[model samples]
Target: MDIKQLQADIAAAVRGNDVLKCEVQNALDALSCATPKLKYLEIHVLKKDENINQFTNDLQECMKELGVLKGILPKVF
Candidate 1:
């Protein structure tokens, strides 16, 4: 309505936009920091999965050997 009131409103809007921009920039910076950590976590999980698979294979082989040994040896009650 009045020029002074319009100027005040514009100033307030500008300040609000600046605050929002700062918050967006902060969020982007945080995401940048987290990206590498997330990648490292993914790699660590994959390695653990690989180890689990290897251990599972080893256990199966041991079980098979035990079965063979059992068949060759006589069982005493």
Candidate 2:
């Protein structure tokens, strides 16, 4: 579930197809950006034990995006 591994998988999957490689690269860029932000917030901003519900929702949404993207590869190839 780590972003780096997922990125590597995507890169591998899309290696032979230019269009798919572009799309997968774009997805990976977005994931790379989002993952750091999420980690920063989780470690620094959310340390006071306040409003965990919102953090949980955000975390779920992030994971859901990864899940959807990961799911698409099997169907596509």
Error of 1 at 56 (Å): 0.4
How many clashes does the backbone of model 1 have? 0
Clashes of 2: 0
Q: Encode model 1's per-residue lDDT on 1-77: one tens digit a residue.
A: 99999999999999999999999999999999999999999999999999999999999999999999898787543
- Backbone clashes, each candidate: 0, 0
Model 1 stretches with alpha carbons more than 4 Å out: 75-77
lDDT of 1 at 58: 100
The CA lDDT at 27 in model 1 is 100
